[model samples]
Target: MRKVWVGILMFWAGLAQAEEVVIAALGDSLTQGFGLTQAEGFVPQLETWIQSRDASVRLINAGVSGDTTAGGLARVAWTLQPEVDGLIVALGGNDLLRGIDPNEVRKNMEGIMRAAQTAQVPVLLIGMQASNNFGTEYKADFDRVFPELAKSYDAAFLPSFFAGLSDGEGPQDPAALRQWFQADGIHPNADGVSLIVEAVGPKLEGLIAKIDAVGE
Candidate 1:
């Protein structure tokens, strides 16, 4: 009876550990939790959101401030380590800010996706849009890179990382959006991080489901 009970305990423990998923969040300062407390940053907040949904998951922050898609591509191999079960690719903001060529961004993103594919890890591609200041043609081209790549790679897609922050009635009103950002007006504040987490949480859950389905 004692040996049987020990075996049952070990099995349950293994099952619990199996439920814990390790997700690597690969991106820019936003993923790094810039301008926010460590506990309030994107990774931590995202983890909290995941736990709230009763999912056992962990997020590894591989974000570098001002990193472009090329940068992300360069680090894909190392970031997607042996224990990494999935990836969250949230790059391209710096590429947009620097007005880098959309085709180049697309290629770089494709490379990153391919790297993830080779590792047999699922990906969640988070997209960003170019501001109007970059002009209509640039905006259109930049906007298409994400969804196109996501479709081609069969990755999960989050159209805009900052989707729920505005109601569309006053997008241009900095005052209305001010509360969502820090003084730099670029990286989100803690409140903004919460909103972003809420918006992306469901999609993340879907990605987790994919990972579980694949037995990763």
Candidate 2:
């Protein structure tokens, strides 16, 4: 009986550990928590938020400052290790900044999603909106990349990384959100990350639930 009880306990412990999923966030500085302290960065705050909600999910910060879609594609295969249960893809901001051709951006994004798919890891893709300064045609093409690929791959999707900062009428208004940004008029400050965490946290919860449900 004692040996049987020990076996049962060990099984439970292993099951509990298995339920705690590891999620890798792939992106640029936004995911990396640039211009902010380690604890105040996006991944940390997001992890705290998940913990607060009683989730057993851990986030890996795979954000590189100033990385474009090409950069993310370059690193994604290695990012999807066997232990990584899910991924949050948030690249393309720098691609927009550089006005890279939307087709190229889309191709890179496709590569990333395909890598995640091949690894059998689920994905939560975060979109980036292009500046109107890039031209309306360009903005339209760039904006379409994320959602379209998400559908193609059956991946979860968010319309924009900055969706947390929006007032719901339209795209993020710079003047309205000026206080939330750093001096460079880019990158969210600590407080801004808090707000973003609030918005993205629920989606993350959904991902965790999916991971648990599928036993991934």
Candidate 3:
């Protein structure tokens, strides 16, 4: 009886130790792996990277192609299920591309963040910058939106998630960013998405660590 009880206790302990950390990757085509297949997308690569470090993470890819901030807002409750422990929000690219009002984008993002906070999920806001060709005023408005939203929401901020990528400048001779894009000239290739996962890994780890520490 003693030996059987010990074995049962050990089984429970192992199960507890193997609990998964659920993470949600929510955004646009970039999150959906636009240029490449789903397996090669950012979230899959990120999940692989996370598992390499800690094998218990489950990263959910909630990306929607052609999804705008409004769409993300609409689907937040359903998409961000209760299992979500952390959220990586990579949005607003389509908003800027569509020339949507910066204020509207801000409002939508704020609403999303509010919902995340209410759910007690940690958030990491991925930022994007508009093309200078959009004019200085428009670029400024779009560029400033992310930082402000990050600050207001008290979320981790990644300034210009594709900071090194070029808008045009020729894909072959892509302004030092050729290596990070697929043939599409817009969406990140598998290699490019891998780079992003690598760049953001440390930040994500830090946030996870902090959360774990608080529970201790």
Q: Which candidate number maximizes lDDT?
A: 1
Q: Candidate 2's residue-wise lDDT over 13-85, tens digit each?
A: 9998877789999999999999899999999999998988778878999999999999999999889988999
lDDT of each: 0.90, 0.88, 0.80
Candidate 3 weakest ten by summed lDDT: 163-172
TM-scores of the candidates are 0.92, 0.92, 0.86
- The candidate 2 region of ten consecutive residues with least summed lDDT is 164-173
Taking the tens digit of each residue's C-alpha lDDT, what string does model 3 give over 39-148? 89888988888789955778888999999999999978877786777888989889988999888988898889999988878788888777766788988998888889
Candidate 1 per-residue lDDT, tens place, 75-147, comes to 9999999889999999988898889999999999999999999999999998887888879999899989999
- Candidate 1, residue 36: the lDDT equals 82
Off by over 4 Å in 3: 1-10, 164-173, 213-216
Which portions of model 2 show Cα errors greater than 4 Å? 1-12, 169-171
